[model samples]
Target: MVFKELRIMRGPNMWSRDHHNIIAVKYIPEDIPALSAEQFHAVQEYFLLNFNDQQRSEQNTLSQFKWTIRLAALLQDKNFSHDLASPSPDILYGILQYKTEQGGVAALETAAQIITALVSAKEPVSFLNASLYIKEINLRNDFGPSTKIIVEAAQARNIPVQKGPAGYIILGQGENQQRISAARTAATSAIATNIACDKEDTKAFLESSHLPVPKGVLTEDLSHLQEIAESLGFPLVTKPLSGNHGRNVTCKIKTVEELIAGFS
Candidate 1:
């Protein structure tokens, strides 16, 4: 089921299973400049908290977030605009939603367990990282379509939500089922009138085209082969006449063995 193009698609009939809502967003490095300091802070916290948990990729996640913050600061210093001449924003964002009752409970339990362990570790980095993870335990924004659904659901429940910027979706026929029939109709209307020729067919067509083409004989006889070869001149090029992309074309052939190889 889609709510305002945010697909909160149902899963299996079982009540235990979770549903997923998906949204697609495009990204380019240039959009960092438009983001306010608070927005960038939110982004930093988002990566530190949400992404690390989502994919269970904490080490790389921390590294990437640090790199991103550094890059954003660098861009601001350089006074460089993201897009050279275009009017579009430099960055894009998407939201996805997942409906998981058991998953949420499990996540909560895991958070508590990690908090206990973090205190035991007594490391600032470890404690900070664990705290971020705990903070993101309830975060549903990183997943694209989910964010839209959450906002809509909250609104439905009388919770006022300022909607995030709408995303631009570029779908192709390969993924969009609605375009299939139209694509098929267009393809049928643009059908090729001429059928492709096989080797024998092409040989006949080329011979008829008044080109210097060698005559082809049925495999049963050597007499016609020699006769045609003699007529065409001793040093002749032989090839499979119906091939494409230079598949079987042979040139500069003086020996009979090379001719046989070209034909066979």
Candidate 2:
């Protein structure tokens, strides 16, 4: 099988409006020829017998095989589902439009790999590794610790929650709506954001508050960086002045060479 392309639908799209967060994967079954119903059923039965450990269905349609593998993968570790699948006439054919909140290419890609594994089960594929891969995908796309807590807490109270842009969680609807992203809220001021974002300014503010902060210096040139390294000693960290989610951060430098590379 050949995977052609992947498209992330962030908002209202041709496939779905309600379920906007989706991964549209274009794939092709390589070396596949037109087949009779019996041939197709035989192939499908072979796959089901391979996964005899899991529940199987008799009917084998494009969507059924996809959903079976999808559910099987979901049970392997995390929750996964799709809104629908469609066929295309263009070069990029056989669209696997799967719904995913966090994973981009992972969900569809994993499905394709799982199908390949099932087909290769005759020679005994690495089913254990495949299951682990699915679990890893689930964990990879799961919400952060704090974010998950907030989401679960809201759900306990029967609030309507949806994923928001920029790693936020939206609760309720219309006038009663509220948004939370980690510790920040809609009422968080721009000033507070600035103080938190700029590492230099944040250190200064914390120091002024008589709080201990990590010893580091912000630098824009090689000379300043060298000065910081020499003064602060080895085993240092480097990062952009203002960034989030470890965007440009590099850590644990024990040598000048590594420090220079990290800064660069």
The number of the candidate with the highest lDDT is 2
Clashes (backbone N, CA, C under 3 Å), per candidate, total 12, 0
Please give the lDDT score for candidate 1: 0.36
| For model 2, the run of ten residues with the poorest summed lDDT | 90-99
lDDT of 1 by residue, 77-181 (tens): 211112111245543322222323222333323332432233234222333444344335434323244344444454354332321234222212244312112
lDDT of 2 at 140: 64
**What tens-digit string does per-residue lDDT give for candidate 2 at 1-264?**
445566765445575544444555554433333444554454456446546534334332343335433544343443444434346433333223333344445545555555554444433234465456656766766666666777667756666677778767787779999998765779989899889888899999999999999887766889777778889998998889987656677888998889999999
TM-score of each: 0.24, 0.52
Q: What are the RMSDs of all candidates, in order?
A: 19.8, 9.2
Pick the TM-score winner: 2
Give the backbone clash total of model 1.
12
